[model samples]
Target: MNKNGNIGVTSENIFPIIKKFLYSDHEIFLRELVSNAVDATQKLKTLASVGEFKGDLGDLTVHVKFDENTITISDRGIGMTAEEIDKYINQIAFSGAEEFVEKYKNDAAAIIGHFGLGFYSSFMVSKKVEIVTKSYKDAPAVKWSCDGTPTYTLEETEKADRGTDIILYIDDENKDFLNQQKIQELLTKYCRFLPVPIAFGKKQEWKDGKYVDTDEDNIINDTTPAWVRKPSELKDEDYIKFYHELYPMADDPLFWIHLNVDYPFHLTGILYFPRIKSNIDLHRNKIQLYCNQVFVTDSVEGIVPEFLTLLHGVIDSPDIPLNV
Candidate 1:
């Protein structure tokens, strides 16, 4: 029961295994990390609604900051405790982080969170990873630091906020994460309409000779995405408008289905079947998956029924797995 220590697994080739396989696209690591943060935040909202924990629900935003050295993802969510970290991060056998990586190194997307190994994928592009977090409870903030290895160190830290900040020291090979344009593109691709607002940088406007910072933040996501709202509350134009937002270059959608079911399983979303041109593979993964409006995955085949994969639209279901 080691907290923030070597991931208690017998596998020694786990790191190399994950780097070699698991995901089809290296860029997907960003999506998995961000989606996890969104899920954590949404879980807090669900808990608060049930009157589980009475606390001030401050601005729930996911901030993605990148510099020459690192890429950081910070969120004001229900931060994990020491024990929770041990259960989620240190233990991999129960979750399947190692097996999936070993099985599917050639196909990147296959290396996804098949076994709750989403967080470990950071090692693929990062030499070192740090988690500075403070739980919603009265517990002190803690800093968990780890190199690209199984071992880690967790100790107390000075943080006034009750949330988590994950910093990934971009590896020399994966310097693309440091590029502002690349980061922004990934955000728009994977998290255009996340439940929480995601801010990458400051707003810019044309000034005297060049662009200058505005008081506004460059918020990347639509806090209240079209899929999160009720179909009854929205008009046909609204769905069409959001469709354009997702595919500005394409024509209008053919038809759509507003899914909202809260019984055996909780689900809510709007699936649109866009007109196809040539091959169906071109539009295979157009349907984006979201957990409580937080963008999870665009390549959603396992979560949605097989027939729905060819459609083009947004599906924001809190019950769906982000790694699926």
Candidate 2:
């Protein structure tokens, strides 16, 4: 057999390829945007820790807000200037995340982005997208707007904050994302255990007659899941509690194992032996997989033994090379 050196790509348009192939699920746009926001927030924290930025780190929550026709993801992270937008956004696939990670490899703990292609995933569900951002350094804020095409516009804009806001105008085909309940559901599924607190809408309370929005923000994640914590610091009850948090109606697990490994590759997680029923297939997808607390998938067929995958719990490792 004559082995070839490598295959070559012919298509120059990356957006269409991302639209038709990169990710199968259109809902993945939410995970990608939120992960980027977390990365930005994390990068700022790193800068502040190293005395690069002396400003007070305000509330770093990534907020997801939507009106009838648009959804805006706001983060109080290291924002970008016009020049950065030109480098990161306009010059598609030039990864800012990769560069940041390399520079701060020792200082940074966990960063969730690898491919710069994440931003364009917005176009899968959006007719138009806008990025309003201001760098943490003394600089003017700018707005970058683009439709579904390759062309874009970047101009000086007024923004009081020193972070970024990604606004997406919902397309007619993907109008279901504009719904509040739908967004909350997706956030819960993808960002339930992220490192940063994410606010979606507001907590509801039973008022005089019906339910009303409370002053509290509906924070969607637990920054410190039990898996990420030291097992020595936890009790038997803590494991049970976390298991129920993952499976609300299920009974107490028969046994549980707390995993904390850092040899070949860093890994941390907890596995619970749930009360197995005759229908084994039902339990196959119970084990959730993550990369640096960002939910990757519930399917872990390749990562673990076929039988062990039936156990319920979580496994997170930044080193896991996922195809997605």
Candidate 3:
């Protein structure tokens, strides 16, 4: 049996493994983490609809704020309690967080929550991480703070809201997360259609000679995306319109498949077959994967059949693993 409150069985060796072998695309770490936040927020909405919680649903937004020293991802969602954290964060075995990190530490894109290790990927970019969260239940808010080492401290905190605020103390090596442009790019790439609104910064308008902040929050996502809606309610033009929303520069898609299965597993979305222009590899990443409209990966080859990856537009399937 593993020790309680321990980070990982093979914690020390995992970072090196991630840096060397796991993800071919290191920049994708930002996408994965933000998507996970979006998924959590959407799940809360679903729960609320079923009368799980009667609390007021505030602005369901995922805010990405970055400064010189840290990058913070805050979300209004269903947060984990201490016991949930112990089950999800502390234990490590074959399919545990430690083993997953060691196996995919190098591949940043590979460090998704396939083995339920999505939250821990924060360690890859930060020297220290703090999770300030309050569960939807009437429990007191808690702050779970951890450094890169195996030790962590979870204590009660004063959070007025019911959500999570993940603060990543940007490490000396991974300071790129602190860059405003870089963070914005990741948000646009990974979180354009999340069920809840995601805000990266203030809405800017060209004023006088420079960009000036507007009263509007710069929302980065479409809370109610087309994929989440019933196909009967949508027309061919609606699907075409959404396709252009995804690929502005590209030509119209050939045909589309509206996937809305909820029996064996929950899945929904519109997969459009774009016009392939000879170079299949160039168009390989055009198909975007979303868990409840929160973008998870553009590389959807593994989750969808290999043939489906050639298509463009969105595939919003909660059944698919975040890592895939």
Candidate 4:
């Protein structure tokens, strides 16, 4: 049955507020959406690990693609039911503006919208947003769409995949997001070390005087990064290889330290003392931050001690509440 209803919002101006105030930058919408996909993929992994889902854990890759009118981010992860769409998408769960601000006050990338605003962040760049999803359970697929307003339409749909696809109808103001180069740059910046592989399109090659896509999908993320594995599993060359993955253009580090502690909060990573050629202050953002191997941000002054930001490396931990 098709359903139509108004999204539960305090005021009609809520969409504008989300566009202007909820996120500091429009590019952050990409990170929030991709992170949500990663969360879904991770949840499926957990379920399969516990033997709750007796299905093959197929290639759990998140994909980002765009055409002339829309940009679609699809993931082979656990999807939601129609009722879940009503609860999570149509409802505004946060109490008020004060509580929202207070909750994310310290987070620079803004907390993962735990208050339920992350999905809506798409409005900052899209005129209309669509979600076509099929749950792993034996439930009917669903399609939910909203056009930059409090009203939304929901209905049953046919989907062969067992995951979610978030489609954003690009707006004129945010047309830059439709560019392949821009999209690649954003993916590299925000999702280089994500736990799940992310494919933007396909690997391209020069053929017949034109660039053509090869058979391989252009997977953008490193699902198993150096920080997530044990120190014993990695040799000096392996560490160096991972370093080049993180910093492709930088020189090899002089020495590196591996941190693995699980007491108060889980933390594991490799810290490298790079050959600094410039002022110490210039190398502050050498370290990248990750939560459960999802690339959070390069700005780690808030998490890493100020004095320690001079070094180059990656830190992955679930304990650190990354606002990004």
Candidate 5:
């Protein structure tokens, strides 16, 4: 079946709000898309663990690829059916750009992504966006596409895999995202410790004064980071190694704290205090926040106590609701 309709929102004013508000930090689109992919992959793992999914869980990794015109983020995770698309995409039940603007019109700082507007953030850089998806169920696959407008198209599509691919046709203004070096840097900063492996093109080597791709995949995340594991299972050297992994060029941390609380809210991470004889302000906001391993932001003033922002480390918790 094929379908076309306007996205069910009260206002067409949402697009302008997203472009104007999110323009200052539009690079976060990559993080939001990749984080959604990780969430899907992790959900599949959870289903498999609970004996709900009987099929083989294959290489559950996310891939980001770009050509001249489009950038595609693909994942071997639980995908959405056509109806799912209608519910999640076409419908606007949850809080969104419209509500966001209305609620925080007076206070700009209060304007964070509390609404589930992360997917819409693609409009900050893309002229058109597409989602090609095949659910793990036996249902048929589908493709949903939209310009930076209220109307969108949904149609049946043939897909050989059970996953989703978010394709963004880059706009003229956001051409910097097409560069390989720039994409690599963004991935490193935003998704280095994601739970699922993320592959961006292939391993490259310098040959004949130019970089060439190798046969191996250029996987970019640490699936089993130190923070996500049990403290008893790791040794002292493992902690040091993980610290260096997070901050490669910095001096060694003076000491560290392993947080693994699972009661009221599931929070697990490692806090490292570096030696600071002077310049205390320089070390503030070094802690990176993650939700189930996908990097949220280094500005973690909301989740952790205000005092803890002085420490440097990784804090990952699915419980903490992020505005971004």
Candidate 6:
């Protein structure tokens, strides 16, 4: 696994797979990487819940940082060993997410990755990618790297941590990702309500002449959004507050419904009845859909009833399918 070799592929080379996924939307790379990081952190929590892991789950926050040439996403989750890296990262057929779900079927939480392509999606916007990880089981840290090719390198590395760090070298064409404004917008759109707190940068405030960074971290998402909690635990003001968060300019909701169903399939959300001011067409697609708190789509034409789309609020379910 340490030597350079072509990535595991049955038919076509790795280049085609990158191109195939790239055509849909390269910005999706951010979502895939973030979701995978959340999944890893969740799996660690699940393991701890089942009494298999007793160590401290200290600071499980997923941190995303970017500079002119690189975007780094670091997670304090259950990292991979040398062999696990070879099997999961190097071997596409193994499908790490699917295997983990099946292996921990009785105890694991809902994972995001279905196909093994989530991690590889980085190649869509990157000329090179490197993974630095150390397992929670007292294994040595290892670094795995690959250019925009089939060949990859793996070797031992020094890392004073027990998680994974994914470093993506922004390609010349995808330099837009290097901009903090653009990255912040993408993070807000896709991960505003993720279960884990994502620290992108520092809170900013106007000082003498210009904006300056504060000591506090700028956490993007709300870990305990109202929708994820029980309706009984939330008050009327809570729903209204969440509604304003969703649509700031809109007036307060006339009424709301807390939908909670678990018998057939898991589902939980809040729907707000808003005052109809604009034309009916303007509110056609106000309902936002989520799967496991990750924003999936707003166009729920094929998934839900037509009339439901006119309402405002969120509809989340782990049963919903994800892109990668």
> Per-model C-alpha lDDT, please?
0.78, 0.80, 0.73, 0.83, 0.85, 0.83
Question: What lDDT tens digits, residue by residue, belong to model 6 across residues 57-111?
Answer: 9999999999889999999899999889888887776444344445644421122
TM for every model, in the order presented, reads 0.83, 0.87, 0.81, 0.91, 0.91, 0.90
Instruction: Tell me the spans in candidate 6 whose CA falls farther than 4 Å from its real position.
Output: 94-114
Candidate 4 per-residue lDDT over residues 1-324, each given as its tens digit: 799999987667677767766546788788879989999998999999998888988889898989988989998888989998898889886576566555655553463445557788889899999999999888999999999888899999999979999999988988888899999998988887888889998999999999999989999887778777888998999999988887787888889999998888788998988876778435643798877766667877677888888788888888766454
| Candidate 4 deviant stretches above 4 angstroms | 98-114, 280-285
Per-residue alpha-carbon lDDT of model 2 for 1-324, expressed as tens digits? Answer: 111111112233544544554334778789889989999999999999999999999899999999989999999999998778877877654334346445545432122244445777898888889899999989889888877666677778899989999999998988999998899899998898999999998999998999999989999999999998888899999999999998887878999999989999898999988886668545643888888998877767777788877789988898864333
Worst 10 residues of 6 by lDDT: 104-113
Q: List the residue pairs that clash in candidate 3.
A: 18-105, 18-106, 22-106, 22-107, 23-106, 23-107, 23-108
The prediction achieving the highest lDDT against the true structure is: 5
lDDT for 151 (candidate 3)? 74
Clashing pairs in 4: none
Q: Give Cα distance to truth, residue 187, candidate 4, Å.
A: 1.0
The alpha-carbon deviation from the true structure for residue 236 of candidate 1, after best TM-score superposition, in angstroms, is 2.5
Order the candidates by lDDT, highest first. 5, 4, 6, 2, 1, 3
Model 3 stretches astray by more than 4 angstroms: 1-5, 8-12, 15-24, 94-111, 262-267, 273-285, 299-311
Q: Candidate 6: which pairs clash? A: none
Model 3 superposed RMSD (Cα): 4.1
Alpha carbon deviation, residue 21, candidate 1 (Å): 1.2
Which candidate, 1 or 2, would have the higher TM-score against the true structure? 2
Evaluate residue 254 in candidate 5 and report its C-alpha lDDT on the 0 to 100 scale: 84
Model 3 over residues 1-324: C-alpha lDDT tens digits?
Answer: 112255655555554454444435556666656776776787898998999978888888788888899888888889877766667666654454465655665555545565555666676677788888888877778777777666778778789888888888888877766888888887787777766677888999999999999988898777777888888899999888888888777777788998888788887878887776768546644777776565666765566787666667776766766665
